[model samples]
Target: MSLTRRKFLSWLGAATVSTTLGQAAQAASNKHFSGYPQSHGVLFDNTRCIGCRKCEEGCNQVNELPGPDRPFNDLAVLDKPRRTTAKAYTVVNRYENDGMLQGPVFRKIQCNHCLEPACASACFVRAFTKTATGAVIYDPSVCVGCRYCMIACPFEIPAYEYDQALVPRIMKCTLCYPRIVKGLLPGCVEACPTEALTFGRRRDLLRTARERISQFPERYIDHIYGENEMGGTSWLYLSGVPYREVGMREDLGITPAPQLTAGALSAVPMVVGLWPVLLTGVYAITQRKEKIVKAEQEQAVAAAREQARAEAQAQLAQALAKAAQEKEAAIAREVKKALEEAAKVPTEQAAAAPPADTAQTPTEEES
Candidate 1:
């Protein structure tokens, strides 16, 4: 089969993407990434938070973000629950605790920074990375502006800078990576007056959360929100109320995000590999059909030409035979005319001399 430039390019593109997808899926399933050991993490205790929004102020100041329309001193903003945005990396939301005298529960919402982040897995460009610091960080230089991370994050933490038209970027909490590495506490954790947010090693925080739950079982739930959810997260949560009450999802299973998507992506290689072959087979069949039609056409033309040549030869032969018969007839007619003329001459000569010859010729001829 003839391989055209267009077909080759199509085959190449399909093969590349399919192979990449398949390899990625296979590798993800084989290797277990639970983040770097001894990586730092934060524990957020809902019971001790006072909804002061001082953490918000500190985050804005540290990140050099634009001030909000409402001041940080305003607690009214907590009434309307808000998610993370380009301007606000973290927001404290207030949820009412029904029937419990504990009143309203405030939950700080930010990136959970999963051990196996779905964002990093979804980004084919390698723009997002899970650093040894346990921070899921993004590099904008390599980002393709594909908001796949937004869809991949179960926490829905990644936000797009839609206002920046010239160069939009994904915005999320960095887990205060820069500050943590410098032996400094995160801005939010540092600013918290109630010590609600604790910054420490992930294992230590898990132990601390367990101890709190074990010591005061009635005050806090038995479960740690991020311990095994989505294959664990650097950020853990301890709440006095049901986790669902504060918009924290409890349904995310222990399976990592990469494994969840691998099953579907793993089939792409086989499917994509078959398509090009099938198309080439179909193309070859079409080419074969064209060749057969051309051969049939050539045969038909050759047969018609042969028949025409035969017919012309028969016509020529018939013309030559007719001419020969006409020539013979003409020659015969001339011969007959000549014979009649000769016979007539002889008879006329005899008639002219007949009377004298009958009387006198007897004597002259006899003498």
Candidate 2:
């Protein structure tokens, strides 16, 4: 069934958060949200997992996912570490034994269905949701491909359908939301040969886990994972080794993720809504400033060129004037020397012709 765009976005935003955005915001500003009163859950015993891939087969068939490259019976695939993907909602991984001795420890990996899922906390579109049944349901029709759920999930449960170009969806275990509603167990849990995975109400499951741990203290760790982690998760795990050794995240604390992110997610609309306008204004201002600076730089350059041209002209004129004056002085000195030479020639001529023309002499005239 197709969801209307408006409803889709609304649920997308709603499902994205573990609680209402308004409430998260309000609580973050002044309070917090404790988890739901009652929800179903699953308790996984790591020591009981045999890594047979029966759960994987059940999940594949129930979900109707595409077949894997290798068949379900192939234990060779367990040689390497694996994670849940779009094709497979759940995966059972084999880890080297920490002296457990039965064989390599196997851990069934799937969505933890956190009470306050970080994925919900990050999403504003309501693509993910924590149901009353303790299942974390996803509405792909409402999802806008933000993949924020994938990022916010502390367990790293959510995966995207990169291969489906037209209609990719966020893929993860839904705790078999459809079947559980029909009073049927999740396919993987039901197919478990060793009953490693037990399904029940979260409260009851916690008690059962405690009893088991108390009874077989040597086979299990004292701590029950997901009991208080990230404000608790529907899926719990009891491991022979430390949670980390079995590929479980141990760093998450007891606080709900939504409480931590409410303050941030609350500002999402404010940021996404206002960023474009603010960024446009900033860009416009920056462009205006750059234009003004460029204009001023060009004007300064023009002024500098004009000043340099004027100075060069002045220097050229001064040099020409100095050269003209020197040329005039040299010409005058040469004319004076030529006149002296001409006077000497006349005197010599007159001295030789003095006997021939005595009457014309200057001494006769003076007498």
Candidate 3:
């Protein structure tokens, strides 16, 4: 369409306002994230976990993480809720159901390897990656240590090595990427004595979860925790009671976090996008007002100059007229004096002629 300046400004304002509003709204929508088609996963059967802490030992051995302050066999540490840390990639927590289920629940916590991970989305330097094997990995070499990923994580994963001052790095579960590539199961999965943790492809694990729920309906809550939570994760959970009772976040909707965050960043572009029209209108108005004031000033100056020139010309004309009248009066006084002197000379000559005539008669007798 042919857009005038006013028309363009109007359209820009509407577009900017709409874009800002739309992006803010989209950040909270519910949607799922589907990762690679061939991604591998694990399903943790919380109903079967014996809270043995064997998974912790296996993770410690395989990842060679720093030694914990306490021993891994210490079951007394499960008295309180503990999360994954820089030195520990996984932790098993115990939950007392108060006779709601068959027994107390044990939950192994780690990075979920979400299909669309919030940490990956939050990192500007691309330090985090969601691998095709359903592993979310971080590269410390490229990490700027801004710690934005730490705040973005919904599962509260991605612990940072605060003591490693010279070269701090984020620590989290990699889903056993190296061993999985070598065709070996994760240490935690292999060390489970009760088969509480099941290792398989995500699709197979999800199907297996459904089968277990269908066969033993009374044994499970029928709601697979990670199957659709945050758009699916490599780590799944099946619980006897509600997932919340076992330290799982039930309020986290099925929406992938990245999609919801896209709108919050939209405000940045709105600042950039709307400035063009707003500044242009302001500048145009200021310039027009300046031009009008300048023209008025110039007109006033020209009128004053014209008035001064006319007054000077009138004064010159009056001075010339007065000088000509004074010259005419001086010439008339000289002419009257000359005429009176000529009349006096004629009368004096006629009186002198009578004496000459008497003297001439005597001379004529002698002739």
Each prediction's TM-score against the native?
Answer: 0.73, 0.66, 0.75
Model 1 ranges with Cα > 4 A deviation: 1-23, 26-31, 285-367
**Per-residue alpha-carbon lDDT of candidate 1 for residues 1-367, written as tens digits (9 for 90 to 100):** 3458568768777776756653446443456666689898999999999899999999888888889879999999988989999999999999998846357999998899999899998998889888998888999998878899999999999999998887999998888888888989988999999999999999999999999999999999899999999999999999999899889988888988988878777666666666778987998899999999999999999999999999999999898888888888888888888998889897788878786666787799789
lDDT string, candidate 2, 227-317, tens digits: 8999888988898998888888788878787777657766766655456568768988999999999999999999999999999999999
Backbone clashes (count) for model 2: 10
Ranked by lDDT, the better of candidates 1 and 2 is: 1
Residue pairs with clashing backbones, model 2: 12-125, 12-126, 13-124, 13-125, 13-126, 14-126, 15-126, 16-120, 16-126, 17-120
What RMSD value applies to candidate 2?
Answer: 11.3
Highest TM-score against the true fold, candidate = 3
**Candidate 3, which segments miss by more than 4 Å at Cα?**
1-33, 266-281, 307-367
The TM-score of predicted model 1 comes to 0.73
lDDT of 3 at 19: 51
Q: Which residue window of length 10 is worst by lDDT in model 1?
A: 21-30
The CA lDDT of each predicted structure is 0.88, 0.84, 0.86
